[model samples]
Target: MVKRALISVSDKTGIVDFAKELQGMGVEIISTGGTYKTLNDAGIKVINISDITGFPECLDGRVKTLHPKVHGGLLAMRSNPDHMKQIAELGIEPIDMVIINLYPFKQTILKENVELHDAIENIDIGGPTMLRAAAKNYQDVSVIVDPSDYIKVIEELKSSKDVSLKTKFKLAYKVFEHTCHYDTLIAKYLREKIGEDNFPETMTLTFEKVQDMRYGENPHQKAVFYKEVGANKGCITSAKQLHGKELSYNNINDANGALELLKEFSEPTVVAVKHANPCGVASSDDIYDAYVKAYEADPVSIFGGIIAANREIDIKTAEEINKIFVEIIIAPSFTDEAMAVLSKKKNIRIMQLENIGAPVPEGSYDMKKVAGGLLVQNVNRECVNKEEIKFVTEKRPDEKQIEELLFAMKVVKHTKSNGIVVAKGKQTLGVGPGQTNRIMAAKIAIEYGGERTKGAVLASDAFFPFPDCVEAAAAAGIKAIIQPGGSMNDQASIDECNKHGIAMIFTGMRHFKH
Candidate 1:
């Protein structure tokens, strides 16, 4: 029997009708501040918090619900004789139902140019306290934090004359989850404002679920997509799906790889990714040419892969893309004519990201989950420092070869460890990723490049331990090589490059993406 109900909410959706229903059931309503005014204006019988607390709402209405009467009514166990006697002696009525939602701290902080004081003021203290109190005694109390539960509670009350104990327990669990999410947002915002960058001893991250996928990377595994807190403008998570079926787990994973590699270039570029590794990449004067070059880079491997472009996709690009089978195409924008042509495929996912080239925000962390733990590090934002590059070979690379080497380096940086990228004319001819040995990776890339390996450049994510990789590149007629160059036997690889008259540059930085 919910005789006394407390209703205080920052979101007033469906509150009037809900309070009216409670009033009709002879349940007294206790509210405070804006909620009280809204209910009173609507002509619903309501008692202000001060009326029940016997204390005026001092400290700008902050002290209204902090009184003993409000909590004692909510926390007292009705079935306990001692609890009943204590509340009876103190003249505190048991509050059987509590409906509350916290202040809009997230919305307030999201406002442009919001001040520290404004965000701090929006944090609700009394609301969480009352919710937790009511939820703790859920066996004797029915608490509702979400307005969507109002109709269900009303339906139950109408039939069974009370909220079921199972429903009350679920609602109690929701209160703790809601409060934890709220507090995490506040903590993250404050930490950013105060310039705290170091990882905390204990970290609590909150993400909103975007969708539940039919399955994960494999059909047997369950999976879901979650969006990080705050605005993410350029990433695949922020992209608007324009056509095709819901994104599968594999589609999202491969598309994210293409997007990350695509952002490395400011020029019109197209990146084709398969299984979270770039299969082909190219940059040209226009999107159409970029797509053609990227397709030609590896026509066989790019079939049913993800294509990501930095510029708006035009009709010319779309028509060429439609000739092949691709799982996804994501770009800054797409022309109406291009969309019409792409939509003919029916199943290819088309995504539009207006800010597709936005840089990764500072202090962003890249996290990977492992068994029983998580690996956290800063995002790999650097490809190379051009001025710091060391020409280790006697034959320095020409300006054209230098550009090609740098281009390949950027692609290799995003590839898995023991990775090798072979390129020519700002396009990747072949990529060998996730190999156990450097020599094997070089051989694989060279074999894939085939006839194109002549005059092409090679980029390794890390230094070669021996001269075997350089020897293999020389045999394939590779003109230049770029690597981090921190190996103990670096001289052997440099000597091999010198012997073959191949130009080699040491970037002094390793990018091992395991």
Candidate 2:
């Protein structure tokens, strides 16, 4: 039996050489528009897809490969006698392999000033159809969706004269995954244009498997990393873990928190993260001093926490970090001597992330997982400045208190919902995060603050929502409060603050993280 293959692609990387290699193995090559031209131009004999299907490409080449001849060739089962009889009667040859990639929808949308019509035009139809058809007949046909697979396919054909059954099955799985991800990007883009939040009754999500981790948050559960199947940079999924044990679920979560918090500061900064929340964060004149102060802020919590820095790690910082059993350390770069010192601890993960200080997208969304579903919302990008804040009490905050309030606001924005953070100067006195009730979070913050919160300014990520939080802060001797002021019972909170003679300010912005 003579083998036949179909090739269609928008990205033409290494296609000419691959097709030539297939031709050398006496495999008939069938290809559509641009791919046919490129392969022929490169001195490779190829049959145009129209010739094979006996139909000219119409509707500006969109209807070329949708015909039954192409799909029937791909989907027909080689082992079934009836399917073979039908193929012989129809004069259709079996397509043993398919190589295809979709139109560049992701790249088209990312261009500057891209019109909607251009984006819609980039949505592929026939390519994904052919991929699915070939994938469905994996018992007889092999499919290739990525250009990187060409070398391996060629090598296997050279050795065995045909791809192995295991290789065909794996490639078929990749084909399905590719089309699913392609359709997902198209749907998400079109939905956004129509101003619809709730997509059609049906939901289809696609993520490419990035890695299989050693385990989940604990050692028992299994976990894997999947990245959004599109061009996305500066995301936690794209980060490179240079060295150490495989990351756990909790490690990735804490690393994301540490990176997000580090992005907010322009100066050399260090943040110690524990349980997906910042245990201590500080900025100083030097990166080493910043790490020292942040670590000292809560030495007990910093024992096995993840640390991130905006500057390169030096020998001095490595020496200090080596004293503790930290799980991970991330920085923009590391001195050769510094890495040499830290490399002694084989289990500690070290990452060199370039451009750690670059500004992220201005208006990204935040997603949280619930029991049965996910909640998505626009991120709170509001920053509290002195001019935007309105003090609502007789006793005004001193200059030092005002500075501390600003510092506290930065930390609180990164905390979970119902979060309260107390700070004196640049050091955090106490942080109570990820609670169900505002008062409970406030009580935890105060208890952690202990005697240290006496004159510290308190920052709430959102409004009080009740007067109980104000009472708790006053009882802890907190002198001032800064929060968004939109709750319906705002007066009760104001009344409590006035009675206690505590200064309060409203920035007219809310930061809720659930």
Candidate 3:
């Protein structure tokens, strides 16, 4: 039977009704501080922790419930005869339930210019201890941390004056999980404040589910979307879907890819992504011109792709975008007329990313999961300046071609491995991603470029393993090439470029997105 229940929380939502329901079920309620005052004001009979422990709250409410009497009642095993006898003789009542949620440490640190002392003070020491004690003795005491479970617990008690062992076990697991995450956030923040690297001896990742996705990569597999607990603003996870249908699994993935690539540019740029690879990317002074150029680059591959822009979308741009069947459109902002035009398409998901103008967080991890473990690597934010280029052929690219080559290099960096991008000026003409062989990728990009290949510059994500790709590019009329140039056969490619009278540059850096 749940004869006694302890309640304490920082978020006081719905606690009064919960306490009243517990009281009506013949469960004596014991609370502390704000919770006790709120429950008493609501006319719910309660015993303060000071009364229960026979000690006043000290150290600014930090030492309220850390006494042996409280933890002893929570940790004692009811199944042991000696334990029950000792508690009975010592006038200690068995605590049948413990309700606790830690202080808002995460929220406290979010405030700008918050003092380190204030942040440290918000970290609750006694709450996690009590939670651990009760969870360790879950076989004897029921524990609740989430207020959503209150009604269910009350129903269970009203039915039989007790909750099932299965429920208790589940609640115990949640208690441990919650406390572990709390500690991880506190530890990570402190470490980062001291300018330490993210990788420690032991690492624990924490996330919370945002929603159940429509489906996984395929329609049959079950999938859900989760966001980091302390994720910063300006990413797709924090984007607001202003209109259109619910986001599918593929929509979220492809949209995130588009946003990550879009972060590379601060100009009025439009990026069209298909299957997580950019099919078209263009930048111009006018947003409409940017969208049109990007769309014209590869209208075929962008049939059902996601598109994003760094600038506020205008009506003229929306009119051009509405001509295509896009799955999603995201931008910093959209004009009212632009939204009205785009809203005509009921199935297109439209989102506004408030941080489209903000800078990406430096040195964050791009993590992936595997069968037995996880793979963690720093997010690639590397870029090549004009001084970093190594012009290594008899011929050298002019100022205009060099500018175009750099633009294509940025596009290639965000593409998958064995990727190639062909471009002229500021607009991308073609991109080949995820090809098993370099020759095939070169051919795909050159073919996609068509007549545009005559004076186009090509950017390779990695070094050319053989001279065949350089031969293929020259045969297709590619004017210049930029690559990492780290292969043992670098001389072969340079010889091929010189033999064909083509200009080539080595960046000394590779960008393999996969």
Q: Supply the global lDDT for candidate 2.
A: 0.84
Judged by TM-score, which candidate is best? 1
Worst 10 residues of 1 by lDDT: 189-198
- Tens-place lDDT per residue, model 2, 1-514, is 3299898999999898899899988999999889988998999889999898889999998899998789889888989999999989998888989999999998898787899999989999898889999999988898999999999989899988888889989999988778877888888777667764453566666677888988888889899977765435555666677788877788888988888888778788898999988888887888899899788777888899999999999999999999999999989889999999998999999987786765555434566779998766665555776577888777777787787788788888888878999877576777889998888888887887789888888999998778999999999898899898888999999999999989888988777776
Position 239, candidate 1: lDDT:
96
Sorted on lDDT, best first, the list reads 1, 3, 2
lDDT of 3 at 502: 89
Model 2 scores worst on lDDT over the 10 consecutive residues at: 358-367
Q: Write the per-residue lDDT of candidate 3 for residues 279-384, one digit (tens) a residue.
A: 9999999889999999989999989999999999999999889998999999989999999999999999999997875555654678888998888887777768
- Residue 397 lDDT in model 3? 93
Q: For this target, which candidate reaches the highest lDDT against the unseen true structure?
A: 1
Output the better candidate (1/3) by lDDT.
Answer: 1
* Runs with alpha carbons beyond 4 Å of true place in candidate 1: none
Residues 141-193, candidate 1, lDDT per residue (tens digit)?
Answer: 99999999999999999888899999999999999999999999998887787
Every model's Cα RMSD, please?
A: 1.1, 4.3, 1.4
